[model samples]
Target chain A: MSSTLLRTVPALRGALRASGAPKAAGAMASTSFVRGKATLPDLPYDYGALEPHISGKIMELHHAKHHQTYVNGLNSALQTIGEAESKGDFTKAATVAPLLNFHGGGHINHSLFWENLAPASGEGGGEPDGALKKAIDSDFGSFDTFRAQMNTALAGIQGSGWAWLVKDKAAGTLGLVTRANQDPVSGPYVPLLGIDAWEHAYYLQYENRKAEYFDAIWNVVNWKTVAGRFEKT
Target chain B: MVNIGSLWQYLALHSTLSGDSTNTNNTANNLAKMGLAAYTLPALPYAYDALEPHISAQIMELHHARHHQAYVTNLNKALESHVAAVAAGDVAAQIALQQVVKFNGGGHINHSLFWKNLAPAGSEDASVAQAKGLVAEIEKTWGSFDGFKTAFSAALMGIQGSGWGWLVKEAGNGAGLRIVTTKDQDPVVGGDVPVFGVDMWEHAYYLQYLNGKAAYVENIWNVINWRTAEERFAGRSEEKTEL
Candidate 1:
C-alpha cells in the first residue's frame, strides 16, 4: 500500500511543476537553493530591551522557545519534502503542504515580529513622520484614530492570531485585518505593522487584560521599520 | 364571536385536563413562542476522565466545558441573528454570516462526533462480532484493519495546523472507505459520512501531550470507540444500498 501510494506522488508533483501554477505569496522563497533548513534570526535588541511594555522573560521564551520551535518544524517539513522530491515521491510533498504553511507562516511571522519591535528609546513608538505618517493620516484620518482602530481589532481576535496593518499594493491603501492562528497576511499586500495577538505573545505580561497589552505594545512599535516597509511597498 | 371564544376555552381546558403525555401541545406552544430551534452543547456520553491515561481528565474537561460550550454558544448567537436576516430577506446580511455559520456550526458538528467516537480503552464490547459487515468492508478497502489504521494515522499526522482527521465512508463508487483531513473545524462535506474523527488541533492535545502530537495520535487509537464507527458505517452503507 505504501509503495502504491508513493508511486503516484512524483507524477502528481511533475504535473504541478509542469503547469507552473503561480505560488502563493510568501512561499518558501529559497526552496531551490536553501533546500530544507531554516535558521532562527537574531533579535535586534536584548530580550529586556522592550521593558515595562514587554518583559524580558516573555521575550526570551517567545523568541528562544516558541520561535525556535517553528524554525525547527519548518526545517523538518522542508527536509521531508526535499527527500520526497529527490525520490520522485511528490505525494509526500503534497501531504506536507500544511506543515509548510503552519510552521513556515510561524517562522515568517515571528521573524517579522522581532523586527517589528524596538527598545523604548531612540526609534521606538512616538509617531511616524514621513510617507508612512501621511498614509496613516490619509487612510485612517489621524495617527490616534489608527491606533484606536488597531487596538480594538487586536482586542477582538477570537483566538490565537495576529492583527496587521497591511498595504494593498494595487490600491495603495492601508487596511486593518486580523488572521486566525499563525496564518500570515497573504501576499500582494505588504505588512507595514503587525501585532501578535496570540496568548503567548502577551499572556505573561498582561494576563487576561488583552486591552492593556495592546495599549502597551504601541509604546514599543518600531515606526522606523514600519516606514521602511511602507516606502518599499 | 361568543361561540368561537367558548370553543377556544373548552379546548384549552381539555388540553390542560388531559395532561397530554405526548407533550405535543407544549411543543406547539413553545414552537409558536420561539421561531427557531436553538442548538445546545450535547453532554459527553462518557465521564470526563473515562478515557483516562489515553486522554487526561483535565483535557476532556476543558475541551468539553470550555471549547465545545463556546462553539455551541457562538453557533446559537450566529443562527439567532441569521434567523432575523433570513426573515428580513437581507441578502448581504445573510451572506456576511456564512463564515460564522460554517465555523461555529462545523465546530459543533465535529466536536459532537468526536466525543462519541472515543471510549475507555479495553471497555469496548465484544460487539465487533455484530459489526462483521462493516469490519469486512474495512478489510476489503485497506487490505486489513492495521493497514487502515496506518493510513489514518499518516493522514492525521499531516494536518498542517488546527484540523481533523477522519475515517469516512463514501457512498457509491464502490462504497469505499477513505481517510480524509479537514482544516480548521470544517465538517466532512460531500456525500461522505464520517465514521470516526480525531481532532489534530494543538488545543486538543497540547496540555497533555505538549508538542508530542505523534504520541497523542498513537495513544488515541487505544481509546477509539470502534463500535460507534461500525454503527455509523452500517447505517451509511444501508442508506447507500437503499438509494
Candidate 2:
C-alpha cells in the first residue's frame, strides 16, 4: 500500500509543484464554520518536569503556543478538507495540502510526543521491562547498538520531520523510518513510537543544533507507554 | 586484540588517508564502543553563535549546554551502573539498563549528527561536491542528477512529522543505493551506511519555514555538501576493498 504512491508513477517529480505559497490556516478557517476544534491536550507532567533536558521556557512555549498552533491549524485543515470534499473539489482540497499535512501532522506528532514523555519515577519513564527489553535485544543486537542507530538516525533528520519506530506487519519486525514533512507510515506498519523533531518542538531550548534536543528528549520518553503500545499490538 | 575505538580509528585513518576526512574524530562514539569510564559530552563543531538569525545564539546556548549535557551525563550514569552490574554479573540490572542506554545514549548520538549537519546557512554551498565515482553511482541510482533530486524532494515533502529524509546505501548489499526515511532513533538499515541526510525536524528549519518544511528542504539542497557525501561513499567502498 505504501508503494502505491510509487505505483502511480506519474511524472511525480515535477508534476506536483504547488504555486510555492501556502494558504494561511487562518485564512482557510475564515471561510469555514467548524467551531474552532479541540484544544491542545493537557500534558501529563508539568512543563517544568522535562527541564534541563527541555527548558521550562521551551516547554511552556511549545505546549502552549506551538502545540496550540498545531491544534488550531489541524482543525482548520480538517474543516477545509471537509468543505473541499463537499464541494467535490479534490484539487481545492489539494491546494490546502501542505496545511492539512502540516497542521494535521503537528496535532498527531505532539499528541504522541506528549504522551510518550514523563517523569523518571517509578510511575513514569520507567526503563523497558519484560517483552520490550527482550525485543530490543533480539532486534537491535544489543540495547546500546539499538540506541546508537536510533539516535543517529533520529538526529540525522534534515528539516521538519519525525523519527518513528514503526511495526511493519509484512516484515513482521519493528521497522524504523523517518518521514519528512508530516508523513507517517501506513498499511502494515503501526507507529510504536515517534519523536518530534520540529523546531517548535525544541528550538527554544535546543536551538539550531537539534542533537541537543534529540539527546535530551530521551530522558523523558515514556517507555512504559511504549510497553503498553507493545502489549496492545 | 583491537578495541572498537581503535578498530574504528584504524578504519577511519585509512578512510581519511584515502580522503574521507568528514568522518567523526576521536570522540567516545557510543555506550558500547566506550566503557562507562570513557564517556563524556562531545564539544560542539561550530561556535554557538554561528547560525545566528537562521538559528539564534540563545537557543544554541541552552540546547548545547543544558539539553545535550543532560544526555551525556545521564548516559554515563546509566552505563556506569549497567557496567557495574555486568561486571558483578547481575544480568537483570544490565539488561534493564539497556533502555536507559538507548534513551540517553541515543540522544547523544543523534545530537552529534545534528552538529555536523549544519553550516553558516548561505555559505554552506562551498562545501558541496562529491568524488567522481560517487557521481556516477548517483547517476546510476536514480537516473540523472536532477532525477535523483526530484525523487529525493518528493520523498522529503511526503513525510509526516518529526522525521528525516535520507539518501543511504544498503550496507554491503550491492543492490546499489536506496532512499530511506527513519523514525526517531531508528538506525540506518542494518549495516547500511548513511552518506547524506537532511533533518526535517522543526528546529533545523522552523526559524525560516514555520510549517513550510518543503521550503526548508528545498532551500537546504543549495547548501548540500555533495563533496562530503562523495567522499563518504568513496571512503566506504575503499575501506571495504583496500589498495
Candidate 3:
C-alpha cells in the first residue's frame, strides 16, 4: 500500500503543477503533511467484564481482532490519501475515498459500541434516569416498547448491519434507524446507542438465535453513557 | 458500477432502439414510453449450478432468481415513479428517488455483469488465448497476472461488510486499470468501466464458504470469464482510441 501511494506521488504532483492551484497546493501541504494515524481506543473495561450477557471470547475477538483490523485499514487509507494529496494527485485520493469511509466508519461505530456497553453490574443495565427517560417516553411511548422496537429491527436485518437509537438533531426528536454494514449514521442525527446485528457479534454464543443475542445485549446496556451522549446532542 | 445518469440515457437509448416514438404526444410521451420499457433481469448465460465447487447451484439460484430479480423490480418501480416526477418538474421527488435509482440500478448492473463474468471452471474457449491486448494491459498495470490476482483478492478480503470488489478501467482520458471496492450496492460510477466484479456480500458465499471469505475469494478465480473481461477491456480501449 505504501509503495502504491509512493508511485502515485509524482503523478499527483504533476497534476497539481499543471492545474496551478496555489491555495489547494498549500492546503494539501499543510493538511496531509501532519495528519495522524487512527489508533484503536482501549476498552473502558476488561474483556470478561460484560460476561453472561457478552462473553469474554466475543469481546476479545471483536475488540482485539475486528476493531484492530479497522484501525489498521483506516490508517492505511488515510496514509494513502495523505500521500496522494501531498503529491497533488486528487485521482488517487478519490480512489481511496470508499476505503476511508468504510474503515473510518468501522472505527467510529466500534468505538461507540464499546462505550455503550458495561458489565451489567451496579453501573449497567436498567433504565435511563432523567432527560433520556423523558425523551424515550415521548418518542417510543415506554421503555418496554423501545426495547421491543429495537429488538424487532435488529432481528429483521437481512444481512450484517446495526440498529441505532439516534437523536435527529435537526428535528430534535429521537428515532430508530438501521444502517447496513459499518456505515456511520449520517449527520442531522447523532447515534446515542447502537446494537451491532452482524453475525460475528453473536454467532459464537447465540448460534442462529439472533433474537436471543438481542435480548441478552440489553442486560449490558450502559444507560449512563447513552444519557451522556443524549445530553450532549 | 452503474451510473444513474447513463441509466436515464439508457432508457432514452432503449426507446430509440425499440422505435417506440410513433405516438409523439410530447416529451412526456417519450419518457413514459422509455419508462414502460424499464429494466428487466437478464437470463443467466449458464445453468445455476454450472460453476459448481467454486460456486454452488443453490447460491446462484438465490443470488440471481431472487436477489437480482428484486433489484430489477425495485428499479422499474423507481423509474416508473421518476417518469411522473420528471414530467411534473418535481425536483424534490426526483432528488428523493436518486438513491433508490442508484441502489437498485447498481444491483441490476453489477449482478448482470457478475453473471456473465463467471463460467464453468476450466471452460476457457479459444478466444481467451487470443485476448492478447487485455493480457498485456493487465501485465502492464500489475506486473503480471498473478500480481493482479493477489491485489484483487486482497481488496475483496478487506471489505468490512456487504460490498463488491472490482477490476475497473478508470474513466477519463489516459485511463488505466485499477482495483477498487464499493460499499453496499453502489455501482461503479464516475466514468470507470468495470471489467470484472466479485460480490463480497455474505449472501454470495455464506451458504457454502460460511465465514471463510478468503476461500470464496480465491476459488472464484476458477470460474472467472476472462474472455468476457477481455472483451470489455478491448471495447473500452477502442472507445478511448476513437475519442
**Winning candidate number (lDDT):** 3
lDDT of 3 by residue, B35-112 (tens): 466466788889988999899898888889877877777676677657656654567888989988888888888898
Candidate 1 TM-score for chain A? 0.83
Backbone clash numbers for all candidates listed: 2, 51, 4
TM-scores, one per candidate: 0.69, 0.48, 0.60
Docking class of 3: incorrect
Each prediction's RMSD over C-alphas, in Å, is 13.3, 15.6, 15.3
Cα lDDT tens digits for candidate 2, B43-97? 7667887765556565566667866676677666676556445544556877888
For model 2 chain B, give the 10-residue run with minimal summed lDDT.
B18-27
DockQ per candidate, 2 decimals: 0.09, 0.21, 0.12
- Residue B118 in candidate 3 has what lDDT? 80
Ranking by TM-score: 1, 3, 2
Pairs that collide, model 3: A12-A89, A13-A87, B1-B187, B1-B188
lDDT of 3 by residue, A1-233 (tens): 12234355788766767999788767655534534866666787879999898889778878887788788889999989999999999999999998888889889999999999988885679989899999999999999999999998896565578999999998999999998788899889899999998766876665555688999999999999999999997
Tell how far residue B154 is off in model 3, in angstroms: 3.3
Docking class of 2: incorrect
Highest DockQ model number? 2
Ten consecutive residues with minimal summed lDDT in candidate 3 chain A?
A1-10
Q: What is the per-residue lDDT of model 1 for residues B1-243, given as tens digits with 9 covering 90 to 100? A: 124534554444434433432343443333333455656678888899998898989779878987787777677666655654554555688788888888888898899888877888877532345457777988998999889888889999876556899988897767688889998778897778888899987667766765567899999988887777888887742422321
